[model samples]
Target chain A: MQSMSSSLNALWNHLSDSPLLYLTLTLIAYQIGLFLYQKSGKKPLVNPVLIAIVLLVAVLLITGTPYDRYFQGAHFLHFLLGPATVALAIPLYRQFEKVRKSALAIAISLLTGSAVSAVSSVLIAWALGGSEQSFLSLAPKSVTTPVSMGITEALGGVPSLTAVLVIITGILGASLGPTVLNIVRVKSWAARGLAIGTAAHGLGTARKLQVNEEAGAFSGLAMGLNALATAILLPIVWYWIF
Target chain B: MLFYLTIILLCQLFGEALVTFFALPVPGPVIGMALMFVGLLIKGSVPDGLSVVGESLLSHMSLLFIPAGVGIMVNAELIQREFVPISVSLVISTLLCIAVTGLLMSWLTRNKSIGGYKE
Candidate 1:
């Protein structure tokens, strides 16, 4: 035990300045999360991503490591998001015929959903006496990270606040989306996928993708389209309103 | 394997270039997905190799989101101050949005003739 401690100390000193430590930690935490999630029979609340993130944050706080430093190492994984997002086309292709049939429905649903979410998100916060800064940040909570963050910045909201809200929105949607859909009796995978994607963005789509390919395809499609829709519409609405 | 990866990356690069040149509001990866979709439409099929690579990447797509998610803790102070409004709005609005959207989509398609017809 003493030798192990000394060796651990030595290894830690050797890699203190490098990115590999956090990178490896992120991966391992995800695996642990996966293990726990699977053990729980895929309970939505027992989300692997949430688990991994909580573990990571706890580790960061415990170690006194700044988020920026950890991000430097985990960036390699983050970079893959771009390529993975691009590859969504594969499922979209496979579901193209099905999607094409409901193109009109998809378009209308996306617009209404995206608009309602944004408007309602802002109004809810404002109604609750939330600050104006919170209002601006909440407006783009349904969109993806980079796009949402950009929108928040353009509108003079706190971009970081928006990013965090976006993630929280995602996690909430991913965890509770199915139950809500069930309560509303939305059985069609396409509608479920669109709803999840529109409201939750990538994280919700990820969960949908795991359950059904048809839903996953639509979820991904919804996510991409919502990104575009929010990007264009939010600015116009922002200017119109304020 | 590499060829498929190359195609994906090349599509992304084109997307970035288009975004830069036109100052498109959309994210590059999203445009890249659109371009890839169009290419697939012309190709008339998903290449087996491409499917393999795409599936591999997507299967673990959730893993890719961690770095950004972890970035959340950086703003714990901001969240803590307005925790009530933020949490309430996020939860209620999100659930309401999904329910409304899903119900609308299903209702719109219930006619079986509008947005449901297929060849």
Candidate 2:
């Protein structure tokens, strides 16, 4: 027990100095957590992302490491997010033939999705007596991170809080996505992909991949396009509403 | 790998420039994505190695959220106090989004098929 605590202390010291080291270690730990979750095979509830977050949080709590210190390392991986989003276009491009056929439908759907995501939150939060600040954070909940962070600020939400909300929203959506789709009887690859990305963002894209490559590709495309659409439109809607 | 890295960087730089020039509200990355999408559209394919790199990037996309995820610590007090409204708002908004998009696509596709003969 003493050795364990000492190692944990060493871990934090190493993490504070070079954050990337912490991220690398976190990734490995998450992989192990994932394997365990899979072996137990309860499914759905044992989502790897959720498990990783829980385990890592506990590890940090026990090791006396501050979240900010851990984040210093983890954020480098986050910086790659933009290039990763751009990379989604490859799979999307490969499926261009099918996409071309449904281009108009996709555009309209994404636009509608973006509007509903931004507006409904404000309305509901208002009805529930949520403060304007909470409304700001909630308004861009459907969008990908960078854009959501921006929209949160533009609409007077807490950007940092918005970022956290974005991750939780993504994890929840991704975890329940398949079960929900099945319940809705959605069968088309395109339909499933659109649903996940339109709602869940990157985590949904990850979930879609587990189901199939086409679903993943389409979900990635939807996630990117929706980010673009939401970023441009949310502020306009926010101003009009508020 | 190097070539794709160059393209990614170029796209980012170009995207940042467009956003700055247009005074757009969108993030540079979103603009980068749009630029990359156009590039892909023009070329009709992602360059060979670009596909591999792109795949690797997508495979671990969730890792990118960890930093932002950890940011949750920044507002524990706020979240605890207003957890109900915030949590509900996030979940409901997401569901509404999915339903709206799905229903719109379903309806639009149906309308398109019903209105005209296919090629």
Candidate 3:
């Protein structure tokens, strides 16, 4: 019995170190999330990122696995975030000429949108007695994942917390943003796309892409522009204000 | 394909170098994105391979967020403590931002008559 137990322990250790188990698990969870998202007819509520997180978290908790160890195997996926962010330039370039017609309007509108979302979120969180750190994370929620995390880090907040909040904000914006725009009587796919993209980033762009090509294009432009603007401006503004 | 990917990675590496050397607050990738955008502009068009690889990577961009999303488990306690404030702020602010942004875009572009947005 002791010898068998020792071999079992060795087997578990080797499996854990290999990275294949958790890596496969992570991909599988995302696939499950994607399958459900498509089955639900691309409903925003069935956000694949959210589902994957929940599934992975449950798995980690059940298996008594530490996050560090799991990340050891899963960081392969994480490493792609930087390259994917760099690739965002392609779509932004594709839409450059289209954005030129109303360049000033789009710039001013997106800048205003970014400020409102960031300031409002921080103020609301603070008013509700949230800790300084959480509110700092909330301030960058309107931006994309990598940039938002960087902003949060600069502001001395939790980067990981900011990432989760960013994703959640994306889901909320994609699902309800159109309704909000509709109630406000905002027409024109360009306006719709810009607003959703400014507030929600890439996921919102994805939704816009599916619903209307024009909206998706504008949304894609908005996301790239907003990411650059907020990443560069927010920290400057934060320090100037504080 | 390999050549395009190497360029992308080189851009990212250079971005990180700038951030470190200058202590820039913005993320390295954002700068890298800007660099790549400028390069594209100078060239006046995207290469077929670059566009293909970039689009392919981006098509499943949501998949990329999964690992970091799972990091939430590590912050479960912080989340519980901040849950109410976080949720309320996210819900109210996202909708409000969308409305405000859309209205602003429409109002500002109302007179332009470009793209038939004359509302």
Q: Name the best candidate (by TM-score).
A: 1
TM-score of every model versus the real structure: 0.94, 0.88, 0.89
RMSD of 2: 4.2
In terms of TM-score, how similar is model 3 to the real structure?
Answer: 0.89
Interface RMS for model 1:
3.4
Which candidate order results from sorting by lDDT in descending order? 1, 3, 2
Misplaced by over 4 Å in model 1 are A1-10, B113-119
What are the clashing pairs of model 2?
Answer: A19-A73
lDDT, residue A70, candidate 1:
86
* Interface RMSD of every predicted model, in angstroms: 3.4, 4.4, 2.8
lDDT of 1 by residue, A1-242 (tens): 99999999898777866878878998999999999988999787898888999999999999888898888888898888888889999889998888998999999999999989999888888888889889889998999888998898988899977877888899889999899988888888888889999999888888877788888899999999999999999999899988
lDDT of 2 by residue, A1-242 (tens): 99999999887676578977777867976687578767877476676776777777777777677887787777778788878877777777777776788898888888777778778877887787788888888877777888888888876779998888888879877876666666655556776678789888888887777667767777887887888788877777667765
Q: What TM-score would you give candidate 2 relative to the actual structure?
A: 0.88
- Whose TM-score is higher: candidate 1's or candidate 2's? 1
First chain TM-score for all predictions: 0.93, 0.88, 0.86
lDDT by residue for model 1 (B1-119), tens: 89999999999999989998999998899999999999999999999999999989988888888898898888888888888888899999999999989999989877653222110
| lDDT per residue (tens digit) for residues B1-119 in model 2 | 98898898788888888889998877787678778888999987667799888878878787677766766766888988888788788778877677667666666666333221110
Clashing pairs in 1: none
The candidate with the higher TM-score, 1 or 3, is 1
Q: Give lDDT for model 2.
A: 0.77
